[model samples]
Target: MTRYYRVLSSIIVFTMMGIGSFVLSKSFAEDEQNRKGQPIKSREQQESKASNNDLAKFMRGKLDASSQILDGLCTEDFRKIISGASKLQELSAAESWRVSTDVMYRQHSAELRGAVKDLLNAASKKNLDGAALAWTRTTLSCIECHKWVRATLISKG
Candidate 1:
C-alpha cells in the first residue's frame, strides 16, 4: 500500500499545483483588465453572466448531441428554475403566485412533475424521442410559470 499512498499523494500535490496556477493566472488577468480601466463585474452581475453562460453551454451541448436545437430539460432542471424564480421573488422582481387569478403557476408545477414522470418512463423504455420530448416539457414548465409570473406577479415598487 506504500505505492498507493505515494500515488495518492502525488495526485493531491498535482491538484493543488493546478489550482494554484489557475488562481494566479486569473489574478493576473483581472489585474491586467483593471489596468485597462475595464469595470469589474459585481458579484451579482458575475453570477448572472455565469448563469447565462452555463445555460448557453447546456444548449450547445444538447444541440451537438441531438443534432437539433434541443429544448433540453428535466424535472430537477425545473426545480432549479423555480428556485431561481424564488430568488427573483426575494429580489423583488416577482411577488407570490397567489396574486394570479388563473392559477397558472400551479398548472405549470403540475406539468413539470407530469413531464418528469413521462421522462422517467421513456428512459426505462430506452426511447430517446420520448425522453427528449419530456425534457423539453420541463423547460416548457418554466415558460408557463414565467408567463404567469410576468402577468400577475407585480414588482414591489
Candidate 2:
C-alpha cells in the first residue's frame, strides 16, 4: 500500500507541474504576440487627432464666410460685407482657428484678421474703394498662408 501511495503522489505532482508549465508558456506567448502587434497610441495622441479634425471643420466654415465677403462686394451690399467681415474677425480669434506653433503662421493669421477688420471698418463708413482694397489684401494673405502651409507639409513628409 505504501508503494502504491508514493507512485500516486508522484503522478499527481508531475501532472500539476505539467499543467502549470502549459499555462505559463501560453501566457508568455500571448505577451509576446501583444508586443509584436501594432503599437497602441497614447491617449493624448488620439485626443489631439480629434481636436485637429474639429479645427479643420471650423476652418472650412471660416473659409466659406471669407468668400462671402467677395460676394458681398460683387453685390455692393454693405450689410453683407459687414456680416462677412465680422464672421472672419470672430473666426480669427477662435481657438479652433489656431492650430500652429509657427511664428509665420501666426503672422499670416494676424494679417488676415487685420485685413478683415479693415474691410469691416470700410463697410461701416460706406467706403467701397477702401473695402475693395481690404478685400484684395485679405485674399492675398489667404493665398500666401495656404501656399506656405502646403510647402511646409510637403517638406515634412
Candidate 3:
C-alpha cells in the first residue's frame, strides 16, 4: 500500500508540473510575439485603418470648409459662406465618401448636406439668423460624425 501511494503522488506531481510548464510556455510565446511587434489584427481593425487613410483628405477638407464657414459668418460675407457650404456639399458627394454603406454614415452625410442647403437658402434670402442656426446644426452634425468615427475606427476595442 505504501509503494502504491508513493507512485500515485509522483504521478500527480509530474502531471501538475507538466500543466504548469505548458501554461507558462504559452504565455511566454504570446509575450514574445508582442515584443516582436507582429501582433495579429482582426478584419475590423484592418478595415478601420484602411478607411482612416482613405478619408484623411476628406477630413482635412471638412476642417478647412468649417473654418471658412465660421469666418464667413463672422464677417457677414455671403460669398464666403456659400463657397464653404458648397465645398462641404461637394465633398460629401465625392467617391471617397462612400467608404462605408452604413446607415448611420449615410444619415450623417445627409444631415450635413441638408445643413449646407439650409445655409445656402439663408444666404440667398439674406437671413442672418437662419444662417447662424444652420451653421450650428452643421457643427453639431460634424461633431457627432467625428465622435462616431473615433469610437468605431480609431479605438482598439
For TM-score, the strongest prediction is: 2
Best by lDDT: 2
Candidate 2, residues 37-142: lDDT per residue as tens digits? 7467899888877887887888787788877888889989999989989988988888766667699989999999899889999999999999999999998998
lDDT of 3 by residue, 36-97 (tens): 98557999888987877777867899889989988989999988888898898888889888
What is the Cα-based lDDT of residue 47 in candidate 2? Answer: 89
lDDT string, candidate 1, 1-157, tens digits: 9999999999999999999999999999989988998477899888977866865564354234322213223332433433332332232222222334455656765675576566656655656677677667755775777676666664431
Least accurate stretch of 10 residues (summed lDDT) in model 2?
148-157
Q: How well does candidate 3 match the true structure in TM-score terms?
A: 0.64
Q: In model 1, which runs have C-alpha deviations exceeding 4 angstroms?
A: 1-102, 155-157
- Alpha-carbon RMSD to native, per candidate: 15.0, 12.0, 12.8
Local error of candidate 1 at residue 141 (angstroms): 1.3
TM-score of 1: 0.36
Off by over 4 Å in 3: 1-51, 155-157
Question: Candidate 2 versus the native: TM-score?
Answer: 0.65
User: What are the lDDT scores of the predictions, listed in order?
Assistant: 0.57, 0.88, 0.87
Per-residue lDDT for 100 in model 3? 60
Candidate 1's displacement at residue 68, Å, is 17
Order by TM-score, highest first:
2, 3, 1
